[model samples]
Target: MNHGHDLNRRDFLKISSLFLAGSAAISSQVGQALSSTNTAFAKDDREEVVHSFCEHCFWRCGIAAHVRNGKIYKITGSEHHPLSNGKLCPRGTGGIGQIYDPDRLAHPIIRERKGGKSSLRKASWDEAITYTAEKLYQIKEKYGPEAIAMLHHGYGYTFFKEMFKAFGVNKFAKPSYDFCCGPRLQGYTMTYGHGTGTPEGIDMMNSKYLLFFGTHYGENMHNTAVQEISEGIRRGLKIVVFDPRFSTLAGKAEKWLPIKPGTDIAMMQALMNVLISEELYDKKFVAENTVGFDELWAEIQHMTPEKAATITDIPADEIREIARTFASYAPAAAVHPGRRTQWYADGTQRVRAIAILNALTGNYKMPGGVVKYEKFKLPKPEAHPHPHFKKDVWSKYPFFVQTKPENSITSHEVVQQTLEKEVRAWFVYGVNVPETITLGRKTAIEAMQKLDFMVAVDTLPMEVTGYADIVLPECTYLERYDDLDGGRPYRTPFVSLRQPVVEPMFDSKPGNEIARMMAEKLELHGVFEDSVETYLDKRLNKVGSSLEEVKKTGVLVGEPTNLYRKPGEKLTFKTPSGKIELASAQLKSAGFDAVPKYIKHPEPPQGYYRILTGRKPMLTFGRTANNRFLNELPTARENEIWVNPRIAQKHALSHGEYVHLKNQAGIVSEFPIKVKVTERIREDSVYMVHGYGHYYKKLKWAYKKGASHNQLISKADIDQSTGAVGFQNNFVTFIKEA
Candidate 1:
């Protein structure tokens, strides 16, 4: 829903009062009411509108920030943007809450060890930057540039990435790669010869049948994907969901199969077996456009529906019927490659099976199936001179995507190297290290303690900042001009800008300025030779556009390219064999299974259940956890552990009862979690929203609000081929209040 509608003065004041009631540190000017209705505002009241992109989550939807009297009043979706399509998520509207949060990092600080007690003291930006640069240089001199690494998350990390590259620190890791998108990316790249684009190339609006295995669209709240799914539903799209918990998307599905957790590969193999044995697969497509069909069939030939039913708990007859129905839809059906798919050690293979299933149906580039989305082709500006980055591959995984300069290794690998004394210093940008699932909170802290130096750049005093040798407070997205976003792939190719909506509030600076300062401190020249505006304009001018024109609309749109494959067109993939590899030779060469094999994961012990994690629709984990506006809703207040009624009965737990969870490794949850005894989940598993239970006292709103899902991850099952950390192997048991 749009948040840009007109509001009367009384309504605006009421909202402002309620918003400011939570914290005293919020600026009084920020509490000033701005009535969108012309009748409610005085004729002299100054008003301005700034169009930019959002940083609430990775989708980066276009936002129109409403500024009245030099203070941001509201944010709404830009109609010109393809991702948002004039509709914004709740997190986008809550951007004000983040900017006005009381606990935001107001200034730069440096950790000092005085009288043998470590404490964070306020420091000037110069002092903080110089100190951080000197320490990083010292580490580089002693341990070499390979010793320094950067663990980043948000879109603001582009500048710091360049700064690190200039300093000869090529080691970089994005934690989301390790825990969320790594397996899916590597799996699809291996099978299809290209990674799945951001707005995943799903032709949802034209689809007749869509299959989802734990991909909850509604709860994830990716604006464009959710909007397309709604449109697809209106056009008679049928959905089949296989998940342990009945998610928001499951509620919209025609069928919700509560498949056993960690048994997705078995179910997929059964589907393949049904298709091949019954001659339901597209024979023409398999022969003309795919490779390794015989090898794939041989692998799945014995994984019959009856065999999978025993492993997945779905009836054999039901599996066959679903497979037949899916096949009946032909090119109009697809098994969606879900996000955050790193569940078991075989996650890459599980997704590979999904790719094979899609290929078997000839849905590779079909209108109603998987299509390739394109990014806006923006020419890169000339680079500044620097030493060639060290080409050392840190991850031992043979199939790791080492060509990607942004994230060459997994964050867990960085942690391992840090513990091994190979890595000496760290630059953490936007990511909350302990809360983000790298190797778990304990191991993350251990690596942090072991580091010779650590610098954290953030908008708030998150858990990561508490451990930093130097903390540089970055302004919120509302007060920043980040690099142009031409990387997001979409149906209508476009580049979005991130111009400032308001002036920087406190002593905080934008990431671009922070990185530039760090570069100057390190004696790096010509890297940031031009202002951010000049640099942006130069890049935009190459494409016959300017910063002034893009800033007005927030995005520069391009003609929509054809997504679907034409009839009888030969599809040439970028694989080694130049076709879709059903049985990947690259994987085989690396000693991995050429065809996906259903390997049984470890089961929970007696009285324990598998811990499943997801996010709420209104919030985006740590990004919006402390947002007062977003957190005001009852559902957004905190995370609840979803337990099946039978399991609750067995544990003598009641709905709304507070209890702590103890994991298989004997690690207890730091805070108590509310039990939600419902039949919406499987009896063998429990569900909780990720990104909560903040132990950092500075995060007043998010502190100890819910149990931390990452904390219970005492064991990480690493995908050997991709290095994606799988935490679903860890199980938890209830610890009822005494």
Candidate 2:
């Protein structure tokens, strides 16, 4: 539809064709049932659905495929799904590429040397499993169970962690715990009591005011929030976006504040001062619901308008005006808790500051705000507690738990660094580490190099797979049945399962098959049968359904509760406070500043502009770099830096100028750059789209097209109380190469 400001008159014809194609596809894909009944099938195609959950990105959306004989024809969002509403993102629709990727490992390959670069060769399933398990056993016997580590990415890999624990390996990690969202969870649980992975859900459509700090839900590629936010925009909600870059969502926002990266805390505190000084804050809610106000007030008193002005580049008057707006809107005004918090060392504190604003505004547990959601109930095969490991490899690492006796290890802190000393081998399940690791690619590479044994379970040849002793090619989500985790709660109440849409295109196997094989090899067949179909059936029975039922319905949905509101009654948080916290009492005791504070980020030197990393909606972090549909989506090519024309002229840099961007890391990449001088962005910083300049020659569309910001990042981390890396915190000099 509406192209809005992104429209160009001459480009209209091309846009029309693209829009029509996309719309027609969406229409057919969304209403697959209707289209299926009308189509005539040739004997060349016998369509059958293999139910599965999507692993395209982390959302794990459920799907039931339409297959013809042995080949999958297409994949659509499960109509019976409670969460997705039968809608899939572009990535989900592009499932075919992953299934039929040409470079997919045909069979397991063992590197000739123990510590060596991996090359593909024929490997029998038996030999691969036996050799890998034997090596793990050897490492356990020699260096102790702590010597072996497992780093998992998606929630599905929790099963592998279970396998590790069953095998007496306790040194396991998932990026979600430490590097991605750990600090924010720590901040929230330390303050309020529970942390949600995304916010159970954001009530954007009904909210009056929507405020964001570092979150960009629209471009973040989580479709649930993006879809809802779009609805909110249609309803004309007061949407305010606060981030350094002018993102797609920010461009659509009523107000966009292009602040300096990492200066959020100062602005938030300034707003708090305004709220309290003018009595705009909800006094009743604060008095009755919160504790430690005196301490918080004491700090806010000193973090005055003048001091906040100096700390945050935002002028004092603007901060006061925004604070008035925040409190003025009150109750239903929601602050979005975004995905990653491990960007800056101070990330936890930053999110805490944002949460504090929520408390002051009395938005907690209210409709049209951050509602306290009731957990969804589903029947699943019972999973008991993990068995005691030989030793706790994560014993040295400290993690913040929401409840009593809670202890979980931080992924960023000690889990990774201690890999060589405390851990001998690693089992990587469904995670791409090289691209995900911040500023530690070399260190990660070295650690992976030292491993006695390792295995990477994925579809394509990811960067981490290069070092794997065994690379098990996994079937795409379209090909196998997964556990109920995909539609576990938010998506649907009925346990949706993934089945085969086609016999795997290559010699690839589903992750479950690999798991089952490992289980049998380790003689844990009784406790853990690694068959995904068997597990799918087991979970199906719990939901009062079976594999046959899943095949018929595609997905199962519970009765819609009028709205996806907290439902029936308010849900209790997993945090110790029993409510939301602004200033955490638990954090105060943990040797970290209890209150979220403003700390000036390590600035990039003058002349060297800081480059912030972001992605287009069509692609994900280096995942869809191969999708031809998306590859040709016409992104800003070259290392196109968004520079204000004033600065461009001052530097004698014209539009599409070739330039050299050098950071403190001594890394440089060329740019056939387009100079975007616009009011939407800041002149001090240059911005470029991520996933460009794909170094891998195999990735035809993306390879060598532009520069990778990740390559240029200096190895400094933020004060990760916030659990994130401020890659935008680095400074660099940009020169017109002429």
Candidate 3:
């Protein structure tokens, strides 16, 4: 309930409603048990229920598509599925808009150069595939197979990756790491020796004390986490959050520390200083399970709470109190490893601090701490041959590990380097790389422009599609039979299926079919299954279930078992020293800092503020930004700049006044946006929801309607440990209309 600065009378009123609403919701929704299971597939005469997994967001909640008169009328989360637990967030509920979107590409398109201008022309699937295959082969012959680089996203991209690998090429790109949770993944693996399988491995429901830094559960809309956190709150769970903005998680916290940006490491260091100096850490667990504790203790000698307070801009007393509260709860307390660690240049070390804090608390393998994800193993495709190629940009970072052995390069780095002709061909699937990657939309467009050939596979006409030489139309998830969605670790392990509720619309084909067709054309058919259905059946049969049972039940739940290490076991780690490294010997050996340390980020230049971006519940980055039902929501459509009232008054800006934004690098926004001058944000920072300011003319609902944070970001600072982009480093000044 604390404000960093005084709010103007009008600004106070505007934010009062937000604060009140958040307060009321927190009081009511927190600690409420999850809803009772209700099968969305009850026998109904008017509608038929078809089971599938939602592609709305990466959460992949199980969905029951309601087919009425051969068209999908509604989507409901499957009650039987553990992830969904009979509920869907706003994005999942608005999935119908995506399927029936008017802006959807109806058929394959070929961008033809006429009068030195590119124009899209409709082409037959046969003609499109033939042309695409011919161009890829030509690129392979002329510049070698290594010249072909692919950027893909999600489980559905398996075919695209395999097909390229079958072509003896292994260069791949995904923004998931460099732009998202690469730091958390690397830090967790180094500390725990293996990545927390998909969906994350936090046991929030059992935790009594939860410490969150920069992650928003309700707004992020990870169904299981939201449900669990709400239920935990009802159980009288204590929560603490550190963020500049009053996020949903912050509003619910017992204490909300508006810590200065890029000072998370200082706060973490102070927490460790208290635990180690006070001898409050679990001594038995530390002695039996960890390595390099002496080194860690020695490193923390200078990291006093007062010292951290100076750097973090938080009170030393509160820092001490929080650290005490965290250790008081012991094994049941957890420091939630945040998902988006692509903040400052030292983000990897920041997450490493989080990992170490969890380790010091002896939280792993305990009821309320970090738990292992139990996964159901499925059949892996026959290993495809891949030729050794030039390392992609991700390989430069010491901490960046190959998520898979075949591909280790950073796609964004490659995209940026493509301007210098490092890569010749690009196969973009499922992701909008140009918008998601750092260094702005212009850099992405220029890289695409420089490519020898570009093929975009998508269901909509996005900005990337505008620059592609060929556009392959894909059917929406509702109209496709993708592989099984289940088999990952979760509260309960389960397998969900994605089946077509209706036939493919227009001339668009399923992603698997597109992959198969490409493979057949390239005479690499052995790399793919005969059909997507066959692939699903093979995976389902491993668990004594088939495609038919999944269609009937919506999901197949696995029996619960103890997946975590037991009460008494020899503890081991995968690090170079072979134990949980309190002070990483590997990092020290690699010449990086052996322990987490505060690294100050550059302050904003005069007359500019740091631009901070985050998610909105209705929008999932760029994918659902154009969803009609979702985008029509006021919060989803409006990309207002959240400027502090003091800053606004100084700049002669008023509420609702539209202004252009120019970043420190001299890149200006493509459009003017409304401003919300309030005390919700810090004076030194401006906040905006990402995934706006669309330039694609065909997306009438989203084009030029709001400001794009990406356009204002022209510079990218690479994290030395992870090769991930420190996306929040840029600063921008507002430009009022004349």
Best-fitting candidate, scored by lDDT: 1
Question: How displaced is residue 440 in candidate 1, in Å?
Answer: 1.0
- Report the lDDT tens digits of candidate 1 across residue range 85-195: 888999998999998887777778877775656656778888988899899999888888888989888999988888877888888899888767888888898888887
Model 1 lowest lDDT segment of ten: 9-18
The digit string of per-residue lDDT tens for model 2 on 386-494 reads 3655433343424444433112344443335545366667688766655555654544555565556778877666666666777676666665555565323342244
Positional deviation of residue 534's Cα in model 2 after best superposition, in angstroms: 3.2
Candidate 3, run of 10 with poorest lDDT: 10-19
lDDT, candidate 3, 1-738, per-residue tens: 111112221111111111111223422321221121323322233578787788877789888788764567789888877888889999998988877776677678776666655556678888899999999999998988878888877667877887887887777877777867687778888877866665778777778998999897778788878888888888878999998877888888999988888889888988999999999999999898888788887877788999988988889999999999999997889998887877867877888889899999998888888888776555554556654533353366777882543346676777866878978999988777657767667667667767878888988777677667888888888878776765577767777777777665567799889988988888885777777777777777877778777888668887774746676877777776677878887888888888887888889899899988888878886678778888778778868999999999999999999999988877778788899988878888899988888766667678887788887876788887778887788998988877
Error of 3 at 673 (Å): 1.6
**C-alpha displacement of 468 in model 1, angstroms?**
0.9
